[model samples]
Target: MLTTRIRNVDTDAQADAGMQSLNEPDFKALVDSHPKAIMLTAQDGSIAYVNDQFERVTGYRQEEIVGHNPSILSSGMHSREFYIDMWQSLERDKRWEGLIWNRRKNGETYPQWLNIYPVEHEGGAFYTGVFMDVGELTANDERLAALAYYDPLTELPNRTLFQEFLKARACQREPADRCFAVLFIDLDFFKSVNDLHGHDYGDRVLKQAAVCIQGVLRKGDLVARLSGDEFAAIVELQEPSEINAVCERMASAFRKPVSVDFREYFLSASVGAALYPRHAESASDLLLKADRAMYAAKTAGRACYRVYSAEESEQGQHQQMLSEALVASLKVAPEEFSVMYQPQYDLRSGAMVGMEALMRWRHPELGAVSPGEFVPLAEQRGLIHELTEQLVRCITRDLTRHDFGTHGNMRLAINISARQIADDRLEVLLEPFFTRLQLAGWCPELEITETHLMNLSPRCLDKLRDFGKRGVMVAIDDFGTGYSSLAYLHALPVHVLKIDRQFVQRLGPDSRDSRIVSAILGIADALELEVVAEGIETEAQKAKLQELNCHRGQGFLMARPTPLESLVRQATSG
Candidate 1:
């Protein structure tokens, strides 16, 4: 009888007598060339052999590491239990792959997505381990994580992270525990701080603010930066009666003066608190309740706190529902919703120079919803971008029907918000919206608020310049209200400035107002740009403004915001 024997390749290779003659040298070369760190270890976790990849990764030579334990490079990040579990899993014929923070030979700690696989002999014994570095890629992954959760400037958790924290807080409740409250904090006059001290200083102020707030907050509480000068905090209460104490603690945090760049300045922030279970059951409801309370606090006076009242909660919900409905209606019921053209009257001609396309919501149940209420709601909910696109389409259609501008062309002044300006895809999205219009020589003026220009992104500046070069008119609305007018005016591509209504309203007995008006008109004259004054409620205001050399005026004195149909008639006759 003839006996046939098949030897285990790894066992034979080690002896240089079994399959080592056929496969050992080839396997060794393959392991050395592999991108992953490859190593063979004994059952006691002692290093038997390591590939060149391991040497390159660990900065340790084979001879130095061969007799050493695998823990020679231990960073001590994982607990003893972690190693025990890992060893047991491998012993049980399992593999492990996950993200780990490890220190390098240079003492630089970095994130790594490591994949460790168990290589076994024919008898089911753990033999070798292979792991990919993935450190550089994991570093990028951490950057994305930071971008997702935290504000880069202030280094505070952003809105998304705040919401998650709030949700987690709400979930951690006993049956009879005191309800949690989410405080929405907003800095008073922060925009002016940015304008005066400049953005870099303003950013420092925000960072200091985060530090100050965190210093006052109780342990385990979350204070997150929601948006510009806005913060949200989830506070746990021992009892419902202690809610005011929590609010007082927050108010006291800002009561003291804060110093930035060695300049001591005192500031206060308005806070609005909405209690979970007591005020709201849902995250959206809680946020709305807090926001409405914040607005109420601002209305009463800044630098205070307001708890969400029953009435405020109801009103906020009603408004939220209305906004959602209006957004849906605008998309579906275009026939019902129509644009009323507010005439931008030219002082010289005393006729319409341009008409601003204002959106009006013809609510089926609530009669006509005014732009004053719904427009802002749209802005808060990010529905304004859609509304702006609608205006673009409608304005383009009207311009195609009529010649608007210097000759036969008339310009349509469309109001754009800060969100639209900051949106990087504004230009790309406009392409498809206007591709169908194809309105030649119909230049529409995009009027953005003075406040929108401050602390704007460089991408927005580039977008505005691109629009200017494309023959689109850019106008600065409510120009006198913002202090950055003179500075940002040069930075921005502006073709027009609409004088603030406050300036136009004070023309009767206010010489200071007259001086302001005069200075603005003189500047406009020097700049050779068109100027329009808003809120001409009286003949005196209109006449005074025109005498100041104001190029255009719009108010109840001329005509209110009229429907486009009536405006077309008004424009056609003039």
Candidate 2:
């Protein structure tokens, strides 16, 4: 059921109706009326006639194009070889259909779908080409590419594009001729900002950070956003000597405050780096090594950078193995993990007021593994949440069994990590545990490090405030060790400040630390906050603290961390 329409086509029917052959006027009328951009060319490639569509699409008039070569539309996008091959195909097959970039009379370049057919007529043989603009399709393809390989927020290269670029660079270059470095950067306290303000604010910060990073890098270098608060870069190095300066430059850029939405935020980054061929042979391995080094920088207390070493690589692998074993241990035998309470005493009363619950792990082969060694690794490996949950459950169970609350109603202190604070489920995780561990209304105090507090976002603060409303006490641990500002200190809802062990260990008759401790104690007194001195192993330190009017303290000299039974017995007997 196809219908046919015969217009001005130069067919046999047209010859039978009055025209013996197509004259110049008939050809011109037909070509001009055609919808497509049709062009008639001589066998020598000279233009003969053009349709109205051709004049409109190419911005060329019939007189301007009729006698000249079609090379006037050449855009220079295709090379000589391309045109030569195209002409060869047309000559061999007598037709050509392909995509081409052409120049218009208005000096603009555009893409077109072109079809050329060779035909022999009464006067001569000519090639007739018909083309349609395909510019929108080309633009759509580019947009799709951008969406596929670029981050929408920052407009930077994302992980997928980064991996492809790394692979390309790795394969195309000779290892000996050039060396490249992969740097992994993790922004400190970024989670707190994201949680406090809003994701929109966090996005603004990330985009600004990306710009800052790009500003510090060289022209050929590539920067990419790997994930949340984490970015990676590929730096082309002329020599190994250039890496230190480059890393330093990168770290210094964030030293300036980033202003977004009328709020200024200070950012510190931990940068880890690995070089090409020396540290790894593959792109994935290079990135992994850089990540390991970056975590090492974070462990070194952040706001720093570290270069990958063979020793660190070995340690990283060992840490990974330990992390796997730790995960398995959580499920197989939960009882193997234990929490010991370290007694904190009132200096004036000579009685225990509270106990800090410290987590201890015992591996069958590794013996007793210190919390310092595995805690950060667990945090990095995304095991901190699980570890914290397990610890809370264990401690609550032990507290109920000991009935320490009934004996003396002493407060319990547990450490909380930054990751835990940033977790949206933190309140949900601890609610049931707190409900079970209820010793009337005596709430356990949660000890958060100073760094964790300074970095807490509004959301985290809100969560902390919720805990406070439930009678939970918030204590800042290792008080003087982090970047705490008066602005935050005045607004933070905190109960206790634990003086860092370093300042306490140096306490003496007239040492500089004595004055520092005095100043910290004075600050605490002014703020009406209770102070606790940590790491007191000597009587002199305790006497000095007492002399300074610091009433509460904890140390190995008083009593080493012990199990629930021992702690309960001590509390009952004394």
Report, for every candidate in turn, its global Cα lDDT versus the true structure: 0.69, 0.78
Candidate 2 structure lDDT: 0.78
Poorest lDDT segment (10 consecutive residues) of candidate 2: 1-10
List residue ranges in candidate 2 displaced over 4 A.
1-178, 184-214, 222-233, 253-270, 277-288, 325-333, 378-383, 418-424, 431-443, 455-470, 482-492, 571-574
Q: State the lDDT of candidate 2 residue by residue for 390-458, as single tens digits.
A: 789778778668766463556778887866887767778877766655545445788999987887778
The local lDDT score (0 to 100) that residue 215 gets in candidate 1 is 79
Score every model by TM-score: 0.54, 0.64
lDDT (tens digit, per residue) of candidate 1 on 317-341: 6776787787787678765566777
Model 1: which ten-residue window has the lowest total lDDT?
Answer: 1-10
What's model 2's TM-score? Answer: 0.64
Q: How far is candidate 2 from the true structure (C-alpha RMSD, Å)?
A: 10.8
